[model samples]
Target: MTAATFQWLTLVTLTALTFSVAETGLSGSSILIPVLLATLLKGRLVIDRFMALQGVSGPWRWVVLGWLLLVLGLIAYTFLYS
Candidate 1:
């Protein structure tokens, strides 16, 4: 299969994994970290693949990826602390 097709499948798997973990009704950082990590991967896939930023140079991809990391890190921090 093509790279785009592979990315698409990986994205779908990550999404489903996130949902499955959520539906487990479990709690704590152990579960939270993996879910967040999966979300991070999914976001990167969407950014690089679907958004078509894989080949571009400069800071655009970094900018978007940084934004995603910041948001998700904040989320993890918030949940872990509170």
Candidate 2:
């Protein structure tokens, strides 16, 4: 499949995974894993697809990816550890 189609699939899967995780009534470690996966998928799609960073060159793509990673990291840390 093309990159665009793959990205769309990733988004749909993330949505389903997030919803299932919320509905399953999980707690502790089990719960944290799916949430983290979904968050990472969102970051990947945002950087590689929605923002079109994958089509860019040099420092621009890295800068965007780095910023997204930082935000996603902070969110995951807060959600799991705090």
Candidate 3:
């Protein structure tokens, strides 16, 4: 399958997962795991596919991945600690 098609499917799946999380009445802390995982997956997909970073080399790719990790880490920290 094409990368775009795969990304689109992942997005749809993430949306459904979000809806399921909301409908299940789970606690906020418990819900953070899947939410964070989906966020990371989506970020990676966008970086590699849409941003065309898959074929590139060097520190730039790591920089973008690190940025994504940092943002997601902060989000998880706040979600868990607040």
Candidate 4:
């Protein structure tokens, strides 16, 4: 209901998803999608909620978002290629 409650729930859901993915012992592309989705969702939550950047907009927000995307993209690329 409340914002804090929703945020906490989101975090818990993300954690559960991550744990489930790890427990499944999936290989190849099957592993990448769920893991990456969970990771990106978690990163966005931390950046927008915990970092308190959901409302304001500026270069800092762009920088943080860009960094997250870049790192995640590199990770996905590495996983897929290697």
Candidate 5:
């Protein structure tokens, strides 16, 4: 793997680990929402960077973007409505 890709993957992995720790420590309802969001964001960075998603064609990029948006929307609704 290229140096940049490897670096990105390492960063993403660290972010994921941090999020896991944060989730375990945070208990209140308000903190729960932010912790969950941080987890999702770390996942998004992995998919977008290490996966080389931005190098894909326009249509594929849009599809991935749509999926990301959908996921974020679901997360927002869940936290807001629950």
Candidate 6:
């Protein structure tokens, strides 16, 4: 299998897992944390693959990834604190 194929599969699997968790209709920190983590992974995949930032050896990749992490971290913190 090719790298692209593997990444596609990983994205699909992560999306399904997140969707299943949502369908459970249980919104607690414990459950939401996993969902958020899955979202973070999905975001990374998109930023790397769809955004064409993977293996580029530049600051742009880290900048984008850092932004993603910050956004997700705030979301998770809010969920946990509230």
The worst-scoring run of ten residues by lDDT in candidate 5 lies at 27-36
Alpha-carbon runs more than 4 Å astray in model 6 = none
Which regions of candidate 5 deviate over 4 angstroms?
1-25
TM-score of 6: 0.84
> lDDT values of the candidates?
0.91, 0.79, 0.87, 0.87, 0.68, 0.88
Candidate 1 per-residue lDDT over residues 1-82, each given as its tens digit: 9998999899888889888888999789978999999989889889988998888999999999999999999999999899
Enumerate residue pairs that collide in model 2: none
Give candidate 4 misplaced runs (Cα > 4 Å): none
- Give the Å error, residue 50, model 4: 1.5
CA RMSD of each candidate after superposition: 1.2, 2.3, 1.6, 1.2, 3.5, 1.6
- Sort all candidates by TM-score, best to worst: 4, 1, 6, 3, 2, 5
The deviation in Å at residue 82 for candidate 1 is: 0.6
lDDT of 4: 0.87
lDDT of 4 at 45: 88
Residue 55 in model 3: lDDT: 76
lDDT of 6 by residue, 1-82 (tens): 9878898999999989888888888778858889888888889889998888989987999999999999999988888888
Model 5 RMSD to the real structure? 3.5
Model 3 reaches what TM-score against the true structure?
Answer: 0.83
* Tens-digit lDDT track of model 4 for 24-67: 88878898988888888888988888898877867887789899
**Which candidate achieves the best TM-score against the true structure?**
4
Point out where model 3 deviates above 4 Å: none
Worst 10-residue stretch by lDDT in candidate 2?
A: 28-37
Off by over 4 Å in 2: none
Question: lDDT: which candidate is best?
Answer: 1
